[model samples]
Target chain A: MIVFTMLNDRFILATNLSLMTQQTVIVGTLAIAQTLIILTAGIDLSIGAIMVFAQMTMANLVVTSEVSNVAGYGWPAALAIAAGILIAMVAGGVNGFLIVRFELPPFIVTLGTLSIFTALTLIFFKARTIQGPEMPDAMTWMGTTFKLGPFTVMTGVLVMLAMYGIFAFILRNTAWGTHIYAVGDDPDAAELSGISTGRVLFSVYCVAGLIIGIAAWITIGRVGSASPNVAPNINLDSITAVVIGGTSLFGGRGTMIGTLLGALIVVVFQNGLALAGYDQAPRVLAVGVLVIAAVALDQWIRKVQG
Target chain B: MSTVPAILSGRGLVKHFGRVVGLNGADIDLFPGEVLAVIGDNGAGKSTLIKCFSGAHAPDTGTMEVTGQDVLFRSTHEARLAGIETVFQTLAVSPALDIAENLYLGREIRKQGVLGTAFRMLDRKRMRAEAGQRLQDLGIGTIQNISQAVETLSGGQRQAVAVARAAAFGSKVIILDEPTAALGVRESARVLQLIHDLRERGMPVILISHNMPQVFEVADRIHVQRLGKRAAVVTPSKFDMKDAVAIMTGALEVDEADQALGPVRTPAAV
Candidate 1:
């Protein structure tokens, strides 16, 4: 109630609302990917790094330089973007392969890959930022907004929604989805039931990679630049949103709708804090509080329901 | 009497978990339309032998034949495809999912159109209906909502769901690993009834349990495993509870002549 009054007095409610939707696109997209991984009782710390690396690839490919003009030499925008997404998928596939083939834990595997991907991004881009005028309109297309009622919605927001919609259907109404939940719930039970848990987990990681790549494109659009240094804490932020969305970190019990709400809650809190003159410290502190509160709430609900 | 061919047989099955011996030349033969109870003290290779048959573990040295044809199982999925299903002691049911979803966890039915072929949409309505029907067929009509999550169900209901799933898909044989180890007395009785139902349906069942009453109640032939091998095979009428326990603990031994005589009156039985 106090926050609402402050917003009304400031009269920047509409602006804040629009900014929240736009802000949600990046973290919200990452949370979707995180949802899949967490559902399998796994985590991917490399999500943000994978997104950044893919964005850099997209940026460097289209903004041609003398030394980096391999594919940028008159390459079509669609082809470059496709190649960027493919590169992200390949990186994700490698993570899956290492995990399943070697029987390593997802935590350690993704942690190692996170550093490797970040280093690869820095080495490839020479720790440089690709900025305005060099970025093509095709790459920045997601930034374009249209009026919906009194609200201005960005194309990236629509893309995020569309992704959520497609995956919601898949997770709720498919054999693969059931297998995922089964594998996450109890791997031994799943194996005895004849579900190939390794294949399920491997596919989940790869599909999460695909979603993260799409997020990379959205990140490029939102920032209007491809920078290695942007959203460095995005990995933790995505996990925060997922956990706050009521998805259990332990796996097998969450919804896409909950994740979307989680993303909205995060953006709303940050926006409200900034509007009220609170600095970055309070904003980060608030997110940490929300994460713990959400997990505690989940435990309570489980006990009551069980 | 005409002989019935065994649906599944293992000869000299040997398995070792690292340095510990799980099975030592364990041999088993599962006849058709019979409930063969494999019971023993804890860690007497009952589960190991079942795992070998169900493809969860490969025998270090042994040969398995399904319906008289030798085959090798690389994984549980292969064993399932070859018409063998196992309900592990853990119940092997995903608690978060609904009863219908758990029923069709690994083998979900898909829609018969482009939505299924291209998009892989599941036929949820059909699956739910079939799941309900399957449970009812197994005489488990107490489950009112097929969409209720398995975690919400009672212990007996969950066990019923596991048994129903095995009975639905297991074409050749269903191997149950202590299906009632965690159930209440009433629930245990319900499970025993379900086992009897499966037998009446002509589905061979391999019941692994520590409960002597349950073993004697439902099992047509009891395979007493001792020291990682078959100690003796006896019917409930031939060997009383005392004799069965004595044989399992190696307190009583049957000589070759007495074994050849088959179900002879032992001193303990008197």
Candidate 2:
């Protein structure tokens, strides 16, 4: 990209980089949660649905009631946001409970929930889109722009970056982090070693839900509205980022920093290709190639043993 | 024979998996500081009995006594807290984690003060240092790098790590489930030597194995299981491997009066 942009100079602009960061606010943040679930060898297909559900919850809570034949509650901004986050966490816990109780695979479970949550969002919110004017200042605060060393940056971008740093540190230096890797590496071995596999798995899903809740908030800030129709391919995008960032889909071998870079790589390819005058087809094709290449690399690395 | 009481004993233990009977009515007695080898055929309830002792399975009808006090284990953690550690046939070591990390996989040391208390930060330097010291103390020199992942190590070295973990924490009892089944002859020798060291340290061990010569070489008393029952308890001196094998296969039956069921060695001797 650097070499290509050397002639065009379109992708090298500070303004373009800042806009790309703002554009990736939602998918990048969701990738943080995705990285965690993938580390446990689990995938969250309902991540986007969960975020949409929670964001719509926040939007519906603040919007006026009876306009769309739905009860909006119209609570205060702070209380409504908290309730949305709690709802996301409960949704995550529900996934955890079903997977642990029935011994169901995470892929199948999360796949079922993706449609469930999407339907729930439409039913509860009446499929209404809440505009920025209808939302409270606290809700759109993440979208607020500020100057940072001659570059315009959204508060949401910095917030997502901070999350990446904090989680990276936690995954590297904590006992819970090591247990995550151990459990992901082999759950039966973890159980015999005295680590409660159920508890670890449950905690992971709950934590993933928490991050999704926050991503919902960031989505409102960056997208400038709360819509159930946004980011239709969200699960695929976040997964693409994780795979491209070099985290093993097989679990227990990835890092948070790699996930952050993975998210950027996806955004960079799309942004860089656009600047180079390539159409959407080529941009999508590049990401598809990257995902396959990354997985093949992961398989080759895993075959080398440990 | 000495009049030494069993350190860990179970009476009339019964366990079933749906319609299949695992242990119909099995009994076991492990004296202190002695290697009591339990031998049985494929369906002779050997693994089932060992699982009950290790708290991996709950018996439907049983009375277990540890130090003469009745105790029932609900989980593997409870059994470990009661001073009984088990090395499962799977070895139960995380393949991706380093040797030191695997050594303290479940029980990890945290950093001191705020880092440990608040953030739950693991003190890697301290854990690695202590793990190295532990390997040295166990006389396991096959693995030198504490940070090397368990998957990169040879089969014997991985077994050594598992045995070291069991020996380090198990103060009262250590149960090894087919510790040598996947190992080569030399690796088997190292594990058998590990059993000897644990016994010399006065830790009672319950060894479940299909190897006849290995059992005869290490066992002070051999318990034969047949058709989900304690067929007979015989000592190495009174009954040879052939008799033990016959009792396991139900080809020979020894009278209760002739069985050498008592402890041949006492805890005081160690």
Candidate 3:
């Protein structure tokens, strides 16, 4: 896509690059959480909902003026930011608990919680969008950009990259990390091997929640608003990034680096297509096609025959 | 009869899964330094019997003892803690994980210093080195890379990794549930040899198999399970393959007093 776009119009390269990085920050971070859950053979449909809900919470807590009698706590920005992250984490924990405790399929549990969290956010915050000016500097700090050599980079992008690096290391170098792969690969086998599959699963959801909470903060920074309805397609976008990144949706066969590239791939396609004079429909169509191809590719790779 | 006591034993173990009676008062005994092969027809409670012993299921009534002490395993981890390792029929290996990782799937070795103590970082170097040494000990020299994914391995090598895992940590008993049921003939032979080598190490092994010849080759005593109960316990030397099969098919019955039901060997000389 980059080469084709460059051939079409090389002048748009720098603009497209900047737009892609800025656009990918939120989804990129959320994809980290999604990748962790997917690694355990679980899908989280409530990721975007959790982020929006937490962002709303932070926005409402710090709003200095009353809107429609829904007065903000006028609280400190740091506490509100922490509160927002806490809500996101708790929301994530709830998703994990429901799936683990009831043995519910993660798809159904998160699908249901997706509505519940979204609804709760609307009901509590009165469907009001908190503008960027009202939000604390800390809440929008991730949007802060600086020059990195020849590139102008969003701080949120760096945060997402750091998250990827940390989780990649954890997966490669920790006992818990190996257990996650084992549990994801075969929960029954993990159980028989004396690994507490349940504990591993529960912790995975909780840790994924922690990452999602940080994503909430990043989203607030990048989008410059605390709207309950921001990034409506964000959840599917994150899943798309993970799938395109070559992490098997079937579970234990992908890398964190793949997800980063996956997120980049999505943004690159969208930004490149738009710059190449393609309509929004084509970009969406392209991502949909990429998802199918990625999953089909995973199926082929997993059939490593002896 | 040998005067030495049974190293691991189960008395009147009964397990029920919904309405299906898995183990209808099944009994099992494993003597020290002897390979006791557990054999039975389908639904005769062969797997169920071992599940109870391996902590996959808790028998409703029966009791299990290891090294003369009563042990109740609520989970497989508890069973491992009590030194009863089981190589399940499924091989229980994560194919995507590497050889060393599968060997240390549940029990991973952590790194030294704060990186290990606080950060929970794995000692990949130590694990790979030790896993290589273990495969070497098991005579599994075919696998050259400790980091090679198990999916890339052959059936025999995968079986070798599973058995090696059991042999590494199984202090009191190593229970193999049809270790070679899915392997080729050569692979089956290697696994049978693994059972032999484990027995040679003075480890009591409970082998579950349907192959009569293989069972006769490695098992010191054959445990015939019929109708979710212990039909009879006979040694390969005392009863031929036909006799064991007859006992399994319920066409022949051996009185409890006639059963060998004792260890054929003492401590390992090797």
Candidate 4:
């Protein structure tokens, strides 16, 4: 008890607030998006592709479009963001349509799109990363922060949290959310109950697309460059967070809190490993192993309960 | 004074699957506050008849009335709008979801804000409370939790849950497709009791089963189908297992003895 007291007193509670907040926000956003798709018993293999495509769209607009000059660099950035979201949503709609209409397996469908989207990105940017003018002052304000003594927080992180809060509400308290689970859990039952299983699947992929767009924007702001070859591990990362967060791969069972916690666990482990000077190969291996173990454990628990 | 004009009644219902006739000249009357057991052999038109009524198929020849209003259901959703809900032989219950969640699968309670933005929220508390009340109303006292998955429930309990969900969401008529064909003695008995309870609540029930004892035990009336035809309708007190089996196998005839026992057939083969 004395040691606990000393540790609490010596450690300024807010000292790590800025770092924790931003990191959590980033990881939380990705995890929530992953959770949404996982709950539908679907895997969005193209999330990484969607992200890259969105980024490339934004970059190309800034470099080639007239809006960039008119809005004084800020306009291009804004257009880039909107265009990214639109592209992602369109991709999402396509995903929803194909999966629902053709009754194709999501695995094969998304894999096909992953390649198509990445190839499109290559075609759009001519296989080169387009460097744009600096982001607008107002847009940069979103990435800015102020000091709170030894702590700091970025607006981007706050934005990520706000998105998480909204997503949490939707998952916990919406008819659409319940419908998603219903459709995933039993398509025939859901349809018999008067649910348009097609509509639910459509909405799911579209929403996933929207979330991917948001992720793309954040990613672009952080890295300042859109590269197709980069962030190839994003799909695995987001899926890992979702699985570790306790969302079942089988669908119809998930919680935003679980996803957030799972994301934190993943991000924390990665950061800690890097801090301890672990090599990238070992880090990748560890994360891969952890994902498998989490899934295995979930299955074991289900069997024992049964 | 029949209150609802035979909520769902059909005359000379005929359905053919190209070369095979699923339901041929079948006539059935499903009224409120009663249980009608549609019993037949495996290839009998029970499932086909159910599919037609549930909007999975449109009858090639028949006049169906809902509350005395003539209508042709193009899809299951249409049947649901007319308050005809069917719990399929597959049960149509998502094993992955909990009781309340499954109860309100498609027709979930939505809380809309001003201007109907959907705040997009669900009244989970209301859903749970109503689901609990519905389960209780059906005399299901052993349900451990509303949050417990449907897969965890026994076959009897699962059937009960499916029935309760049908009753809770679909109001006019609830159809059960071989509901108890998968249960044991005690379990089947429990489901039979549930059927009675449903009838007591004034909910019309259409039970499809091949189990003769169960048919005699629970059904207020039984309709025997043989080779896609309405062979007979017998009340439990007047039910004859031999006649039922004969009719199910298309062996029963319009003989002098049959005529003395029930109604006679005019200008028909014996």
What DockQ do the predictions score, one after another?
0.79, 0.78, 0.84, 0.60
Global lDDT for candidate 2?
0.88
Per-residue lDDT of candidate 2, residues B25-133 (tens digit): 9999998899999999998899999888787888999899888889888778888888899999999998878998988888899999999999999999999998888
Question: Which sequence of candidate numbers ranks them by lDDT, best first?
Answer: 2, 3, 1, 4
lDDT of 1: 0.85
Q: What's the lDDT for all of these models?
A: 0.85, 0.88, 0.87, 0.75
RMSD of each: 3.7, 1.9, 1.9, 5.4
**Lowest-sum lDDT 10-residue window in model 3 chain A:** A7-16
Candidate achieving the largest lDDT: 2
DockQ of candidate 1 against the true complex: 0.79
User: How big is the positional error of residue B173 in model 4, measured in Å on the Cα after superposition?
Assistant: 1.8
Off by over 4 Å in 2: A65-71, A301-306, B1-3
Put down candidate 1 lDDT per residue, A1-306, tens digits, no spaces: 267447554525566678789989999999999999898888899998999999888888777775343334435667767877888888888888888899999999999999999999988777788774576789888888888877888999999999999888889998998888888788888888889899998899889989988898888888887888989889998888888888877888888888999998888888777777789999999888888988998899879876
- Candidate 3 — which pairs collide? none
The digit string of per-residue lDDT tens for model 2 on A1-306 reads 685577469787889989888888889999999998899888899999999999999888876654433466778999989989999999999998888888899999999999999999988886778887776799899899999896999999999999999899888888888889998899888888888888888888998899999999999988899989989989999999888888878888888888888888888888888788889999889889988988888788868854
Number of the candidate with higher lDDT, 1 or 2: 2
Tell me the lDDT of model 2 at B177: 92
- Model 4 chain B — which ten-residue stretch has the worst lDDT? B261-270
Local lDDT at A135 for model 3: 66
Error of 2 at A189 (Å): 1.1
